[model samples]
Target: MSSLYLLHKPYRMLSQFTDSEGRATLADVIDVPGVYAAGRLDYDSEGLLLLSDDGALIHRIAHPRHKQPKTYWVQLEGQMDESALKALRSGINLKDGPTRPAKARLMTPPALAPREPAIDPKRHPSTCWLELTISEGRNRQVRRMTAHVGFPTLRLIRASIGAWQLGDLQPGEWRRETLHAPRPAKSAKRSGKPTATRPRRHS
Candidate 1:
């Protein structure tokens, strides 16, 4: 069986093991050798990051073509309304391209400890906390999307990727898990009526 690791990556830690400047990395938190991060999370972002020794498994998880959904708890600069949610659900055009329509919805702020160093205060007064979920993992995609819609993201915490969730794992903690091939979901039967499938677009 292949080896897998789940790490709650803390802010300011590099995603890779080797850093020339001696910055903190997975090497600092996990002693497990031969495992590599499946995908990268920005050094400023905090949350669950998966690592594996199996190259094929890593490719499957990190490749955008696989379409594995990643969920995040985003704290926005203002109160989110239906229009913003709709915009996210429809699609957001970025410099990279148009992002795939996501499963966007407004959710109550999850119960959790306050951030150590709170997010930067807004220049203009605004509300806090808006949950955003996206299937595509583009480079700083969530931040750009919210900003494009006039709401800059204050903080981003990834809650899950595919079948793995952060759960109660605190920042800087690491755990090992066994990974298996994900089961494919059943597809709906075709009908005479034309069907609408969300187009695959780059973020």
Candidate 2:
């Protein structure tokens, strides 16, 4: 069994435990000794971050090859429309490479807490939020993707990673859960009737 922690990382905090200049990091808030961040969230972004003591588990969850979906609520600079959504779903070319197709849709106003220091209102006059779900976790991919489509991201909040959701976990808070839990058996029927009327005779 491995130890897994879900941390709601705060803005401006470094992803790693150690920082040369004594910057705020997981070490500052989380006292766990052995656990380490499975993936990284940039200092400027805030949201769900997973940490684990198991290296293999970390790779499986964070590595792009696994194609684990990560969903983010992004506040962009202008009102987004169907054309923008289509472009996002199609793909966006970045400096490193072209991003893979993603699930992009306009975000219905999230119920999450407001970010401290708030977004710059002057830079973003008519802003609209969008929900972007991507499997590839490139460096600053969400920010870059929105920028590529001409709507610079005003703010970004990761809503979920894999099966875990941020929920009401405030910034700098964390929760622990098992990495692998046994799946519950599915019900035999959906409409309260067995699919097979009776057991067939062996023939």
Candidate topping lDDT:
2
Model 2 global lDDT (CA atoms, 0 to 1): 0.82
**Worst 10 contiguous positions by lDDT, candidate 2:** 194-203
Expressed as tens digits, the lDDT of each residue in 1-203 for candidate 1 is 46667778888889999999988787777777789999999988888898889999899899989988999888888888789889999998999999999877777777655676776565636656666678888789999999988888877888899878887777777676654443445533331232222221211
Give the true-structure RMSD of model 1. Answer: 9.6
The lDDT values for all models are: 0.79, 0.82
Best by TM-score: 2
Cα deviation at 194, candidate 1, in Å, is 39
Candidate 2 lDDT at 50 equals: 88
lDDT, residue 90, model 2: 93
